[model samples]
Target: MDLTGKVAIVTGSGRGLGLAYARELAAAGAKVVVNDVDAATAEAAAKEITDAGGTAVAEVAAVGRTEAAEALVARAVDEFGRLDVLVTNAGVLRDKVLWKMSDDDFDTVIDVHLRGTFTCARAAVRRMREQGEGGRLILIGSPAGQRGNFGQTNYSAAKAGIVGFARTWAMELERANITVNAVIPVAATAMTETIPALKPYVDALRAGEPMPPFARTALAFGTPEDAAGLVAFLASDAASGVTGQAIGIGGDRLSLWSHPQQVVAAYADGGWRPGAIAEAWPTTVGAQLQTVGENLPEPPAA
Candidate 1:
């Protein structure tokens, strides 16, 4: 996991998972650019790294904006000479059911989580191509994205879109030796605190106590530091062959998620008509249609 001489830009690095990623990268010897919308927090994170004898610089920018995304990459190159890793971790949550979710809520979440990752990756890829040294593009994803959440249509869609970006970009940049991957982290962070069921676990983490059984088994809740370790590995040279993967990190568990595939394909001599499809679907594709939220148990007695 030696990242000596490598330069990395981690968006939304002022706190939580992003900050953890930045710190880990810096600790691994990468010159990190800590980008956040909040100027003070970004500066504080950078100072923390520098004070610990690691190289870092703070960049305050809204990552959803193309100019800001470009500027972040530029700052990394200007300050560190070359960029090697780009972790698009900047995001915001706007949770609501489909009917209650407003246009603003949906648009803002998509812009920050989906478009923001695109813009930053676009900027970084340009520089990476020019340098011809290849690089790592690590995007953050969530379980809500993989398996739809009850009241997070916007967040789920945006996170799922990021996985698409990783898969597509992995192929597009493979020739250049740049790897693209997504990490779906389940951790006790500010974001997870929004879930009522996770409050006890988050509180326990804050108080340095053992996690609740439900939290440990169901969410597999861990700290941001646990997720950071995975990101650091992805950024390292050892992970050169691992790309387009949706990796899960929580507590001491790490998982490799399966990509979508045609489980059952039905063919006919002639193109199947609607009637034919109707008859075949039930026996074939329909039978395999998995249940959603199967992993979640019914609510405990109140």
Candidate 2:
């Protein structure tokens, strides 16, 4: 997983899982460009890496816009002289139940998560193509995207879209040798601490307490650092042939997620009527109906 000369840009990386990914990539020897909307945190993240003896620089910009994406890629090339990886980890949560959600709420989440991933990948891929070396595009996804979650319509859509981008880009960029993949990660960070099921563990982590095996193994929930190694591995040369996959990592768990594919189908010889489909449903496709939503067992007793 040596990345001695590879240069990377990780957006929304001032804190949380993004920071962990940036630090791990730097530890793997990649010169990192840490981008965040907040100027202070961006600089601080870069400083922290530098203090730890890793090469890094800070770039402050909101990641949704194409201009910001272009600037980020430009800064990476100008600073480190080449761009080899782009981790689109920046996101926001404007969640509400579908009926209660406003347009701005939906738009804000989409602009940051979906549009940000799109524009950044576009800019980075162009540069990688010009450089003529294979590159990695690590798009961040969530379990909500894999299985819908209540009050997270916007977030789930955007994350699901990110994984879609990975699959499509993997095909389009294959000849260019740019491998694209989506990471479905679950970790306790600012983004997840407010989740009711995770708050206790988040609190415990802050108090420097150890996480229970149940939290780490069953819930796949742990500190942000737990998920960082996956990002580092995917960003390195070792994951060169691994593309077009939705890989999950968190806590003590590492998993491979299956894409949404039909498990069963029913066909009519001459396009059956609705009545005929209804009659067949009980014994056919409906019998294998899939489940939805993230369902976690209660955290082990306090």
Candidate 3:
């Protein structure tokens, strides 16, 4: 996983999983561009890496907009001479059910997670193509996006769109030798604190308690650093042939998620009428109805 002499960018790297990723990449010998919406935190993050004998610089940008995305790529070029990896980790969450989700809530999440990914990848790919060197575009995805989650309509859509980007770009950039993959990370960050089931575990960790094995193994929840390892591995040459995958990682678990595929299919001889379809539904597709949401195991008795 030696990234020596490579230049990389990690957006929203002021803290949380993004911070862990930037630090790991820098530690692996990559010159990192740490980007965040908060100027103070961004500078602080960059300094922390530099003070640790790693090369890093801060770039403050909101992400999502073409101008901000382009500026991040430009910063890497200006400071490190070339861009080798881009981790689109910047995002916001707006949780609400369909009935109660306002337009603003929907738009905010979409702008940050979905559109932000598109713009940043566009800018990064262009630069990577110009350099004519193979590169890595690691996009962050969520379990909420993989399987529908309650009260997260906006967030789910945006994250799903991110994975969609990875699949599409993998095909589009194959000739360019640029690999695209979506990382589905589970960690105890401020983001996960919002999930009711994970809150107690998150709070316990904040109070200096060890994370329970059940949460680590069963829920696949752990520290941000637990998930950071996967991001660094995907960025390295070791994963050069791995592309268009939605890989999950956390505490004690690593998984490969399959793209949408039909488990079973039924056909009608002459395009059956509505009455015939209604009669056959229960015995056909309805009988194999797929489950939604994460299939979590029952926790050990307290």
Candidate 4:
């Protein structure tokens, strides 16, 4: 899709998935503001895009903070004249079991992943509304949030909260022609490296060796570039009709996730009582309750 004359701000674009998104958007003809906490990495990413004949500027600011988030959107407007796309991809991982997780760990994750998206979207949408041109708000989500992972209580909660933001904002912004969507990407970034089960595949990729079929599938699905195309598409005009949706992208796979809904309903003449609920629970909604772990089938051997 052509994004000529458009401007975009991508948080945490110094490396990995954010960088990929920034680069791809730039390649598609958008001026990009690359935001990251690290000055050097942000500058390097912006320079790389410029070197490749694309327009980009680096903004070294940590997201989640109100001032920082506002600054990022302002930078895009100040440099490029208008803000058209906002990609909230900045995140940090502080993994621990629910009981073992510290207050700082929980707060920090939520601040970066959830609050960062909220603040940035708020800042960008204001500009989009003032400019009287529709815009895109693309928030990053995770597989862990969709299907809970072990020892990621804080991370999972933060990622899951982002979906709620997208859904609500889509409704509020639709009248203005703005679209809000969440992307759950499986990419082989530093974040995915934390998973012990994926180490062998990551190692094989790094060493440039041929991997077994299963490992190859896993590695391909985790490639950062594989997710970038979807972000670029969402930023374009073609996706104007797509909003309030959680889209998944991994390698050759693209899927739409189902929204939360009631699976079964049981009603009484007046209201459900504790005793009545107890009697109907097993055969009603309770019957479909999934087992948390071990009951699921294992992956094929490599």
Q: TM-scores across all candidates? A: 0.93, 0.98, 0.98, 0.94
Residue 82, candidate 2: how far off, in angstroms? 0.5
> Per-residue lDDT for 1-302 in model 3, tens only?
79998999999999999999999999999999999999999999999999999999999999889999999999999998999999999988878789999999999889989999999999999999999988999999999999989999999989998999999999999999999999999999999999888999999999999999999999999999999889889999999999999999999999999999998777899888999889999999778999999887778888
TM-score, structure 1 vs. true: 0.93
Angstrom error at residue 16, model 4 = 0.7
Give the Cα RMSD of candidate 3: 0.9
Better of 1 and 4 by lDDT: 1
Candidate 4 residues lying further than 4 Å off, grouped into runs, are 210-220, 291-299
lDDT, model 2: 0.94
Clashes of 1: 0
Tens digits of per-residue lDDT, candidate 1, 159-201, equal: 8899999999999999999999999998898889887777677
Error of 2 at 207 (Å): 1.5
What's model 3's overall lDDT? 0.94
TM-score of predicted model 3?
Answer: 0.98
Query: Which residue window of length 10 is worst by lDDT in model 4?
Result: 290-299
lDDT of 4 by residue, 1-302 (tens): 89999899999999999999999999999999998899999999999999999999999997889999889988888898999999999999998898998999999999999888889999999999999989999999987878788999988888889998989999999999999999999766788878876666567667886445554354335567879999999999889899999999976678897888877787889999999999999998788876442122245855
Give the Cα-based TM-score of candidate 2 against the true structure. Answer: 0.98
